[model samples]
Target: MPTIVHTIRRGWVYSPFTCEYCGHEDQGAIHMKVGASAQVGILQDYDDTRDLAMGTAHGNMEQAGDELIALSPCPACGKRDELAVKSFYAKAKPWIGSGALFLVVGLAGAGYLASEGEPEMGLLATSPLLLIGLVVLIAGLGKRLRKLPPSAVFRSRNPEPWAHLGPERASQ
Candidate 1:
């Protein structure tokens, strides 16, 4: 059986509110609005886990909880789009843009060499910057390709989750 994990704070999302005057109780809804994303570190260790299976399973799942975790805003309530990824990307662009620009220029040089039919070794040796830039450019391009086209994305349907059930707990 797959078990659901509570990754967000549910109580904040669905809070029971009391009227100051009449004392009527109403459940307060938190938009759990889309917010900026947090920086996450890549895991280098797998064996050092309280639950070995959990660690292994988490390592196996690539979509969520690894590079990009769940986008759930809140757990208790229907908080949607809590992780505002686009905004985070936009802010980081100013700094990353220059590097990306440099990478493109390098890739262009590489392309020129390839077009000229330069020997593989000679071509790579000629444009060190371009080689580095091409690597960076390709990585960025790969990420963009994973997302759907701009128009039919959020409107279409919610993105699939990273994982539903993790590894079974080690029987005590």
Candidate 2:
């Protein structure tokens, strides 16, 4: 039987004030810890069962250390395990993983055997260096083999700075 692992994250305002998102009227201050979470302010623990996750509203931490809450379900963003954000590569399609697995194994076997065999005086034929070379070769090939979509081009962090954090314009 397969089981799904649910990851829960939690974060809280250093001290409750205006909503983080709207930033309208300030909400009364409440001293409370958040709960478990993936990142510092990605998601929050919802209920006792620890199934659903709550998104952070908005709140910044203090400097020099004054108003620190937490995420232990116990400090509001004071301190807790960091949030978990999936890596770009990790979210790849299944085919990528399949190709990578095949490449790694193929190269490892060839590499190990080549290294264990014999070394020549003029040019080294097999050694630790060869194994490492094979691993690198396989990795590079696997990266290129992955099925990447045109839209995913924006995945690179280097995408235009403005494209990512551009100012918001009034909606029509």
Candidate 3:
């Protein structure tokens, strides 16, 4: 029986926040790492896990309008409050684990053959797989270049620019 190997990835999302003080923007990211096996009768396990992660990352930004608001100095420029009000969900990238696996297997096979005093056979046996691994790796990288949709901008009813600031700054 071919060991059924499964590659799993956790879901993640992030947004960009610009500092109001110095107009510096930093991307806020949320990632959860999860791994599991895909048994023939339990395929839904992976989906359920991934969906839960996605939901957790996508909070009610609208209701918690001030949740991301901060009064700390801008991380990039040491300023305060000039942060951009708009928040967007970050894009998702495709995983290229297969390419890496292929590369590793191919190289290991070559190394083993070389150590066994079969340099020519090792070169011939590994050359094709190495080339294929490179091709797949490039394709995977290309897929990552495409951008995914971000969540809609969280809107707030508060009109004050500093309304998102915490209560500590409210008295200021």
Query: Which candidate leads the pack in TM-score?
Result: 3
* lDDT of candidate 1 over 1-172, digit per residue (tens): 3222212211112223333334443333222222212222244232322244443343334222211222323223423233434642454454455557776676666677778787585457547775555566666555544542221112013222112223341110
What residue pairs are clashing in model 1? 10-76, 35-84, 103-133, 106-130
| Pairs with steric clashes in candidate 3 | 18-83, 18-84, 19-82, 19-83, 20-81, 20-82, 20-83, 21-80, 21-81, 21-82
What's each prediction's TM-score? 0.29, 0.21, 0.33
Across residues 1-172, which tens digit of lDDT does each residue of candidate 2 receive?
2222334333222222222333332212122334333232224333422333233212222210112211121122222223211132344445455555555665565566667663242124323444555566566657556652211111122233224334561110
For candidate 1, the lDDT comes to: 0.38
Estimate the lDDT of model 2: 0.33
Off by over 4 Å in 3: 1-95, 148-172
User: What's model 2's TM-score?
Assistant: 0.21
Of models 1 and 2, which has the larger TM-score? 1
Please report how far candidate 1 places residue 98 from its true position, in Å: 7.9
Q: After superposition, which runs of candidate 1 have C-alpha atoms over 4 Å from their true positions?
A: 1-53, 56-82, 87-126, 148-172
Candidate number with the higher TM-score (1 or 3):
3
Best of the two (1, 3) by lDDT: 3
